[model samples]
Target: MFATTDNGLSGTGKPESVFISWLLWQPRGADLAVEALKEVQKLSRYDDSDPDITRLRSLFVSLAGADGPLH
Candidate 1:
């Protein structure tokens, strides 16, 4: 699992492993993952109007589960 605060992010071992399993492999570190997630959030309008955004959001939702994103 992972968490976020005003300072930044922190995660247990498993959280990074999820990113490692992906072919694209993004979660290099807490700082980078947080930056990347921020970028993804910014790009996604969250209105379900864009398939790409919807898919990305869905991926994160699935990865994060009920706990939601790192925050």
Candidate 2:
């Protein structure tokens, strides 16, 4: 479960990845968000061709309303 608490307000049980993606992508233009995602991809310890990473790339593409790789 995910949780956030501030000033006695709290939220929990949200998908952390979605929250992370929103924090990364919502405040910026699509190009910049995509660039940030590429940096995340580089920092990941998964295999270069991991399927989960592929899915994450697909999600970021969808978020940007575009098609192609994050790299």
Candidate 3:
């Protein structure tokens, strides 16, 4: 059996595990990042009344075109 929380996959006794999983699963492109961010923004609780939400939306859209640099 497993216990779950608001963030999902809870009760593992390893908080950082979720972050590691996310980092490993993340896509490797600016366009994908932009699209993901946009989806997140849409699902987030922040509405138009929130300044931060608007700023983040603008930033994601602005970066939607760049392919990002090779590391």
lDDT per model, in order?
0.46, 0.50, 0.46
RMSD values for the candidates in order, in angstroms, are 14.2, 8.4, 9.5
C-alpha lDDT of candidate 2 relative to the true structure: 0.50
In terms of lDDT, the poorest run of 10 residues in model 2 is 6-15
- Write candidate 1's Cα lDDT for 1-71 as tens digits: 85643312222223334334552555445454444565456545556564444555555544444255432
For each of the candidates, give the backbone clash count: 0, 0, 0
Better of 1 and 3 by TM-score: 3
Q: Evaluate residue 18 in candidate 2 and report its C-alpha lDDT on the 0 to 100 scale.
A: 47
lDDT of 2 by residue, 1-71 (tens): 95655333122223346437555655545565566466456535455454445455455555555555444
Per-candidate TM equals: 0.33, 0.34, 0.35
Task: Give the runs in model 3 whose Cα sits over 4 Å from its true position.
Answer: 1-25, 33-37, 40-46, 65-71
TM-score: model 3 vs. ground truth: 0.35
Evaluate model 1: give its TM-score: 0.33
Q: Which stretches of candidate 2 lie over 4 Å from their true place?
A: 1-48, 68-71
- Model 1 residue runs over 4 Å out of place are 1-44, 67-71
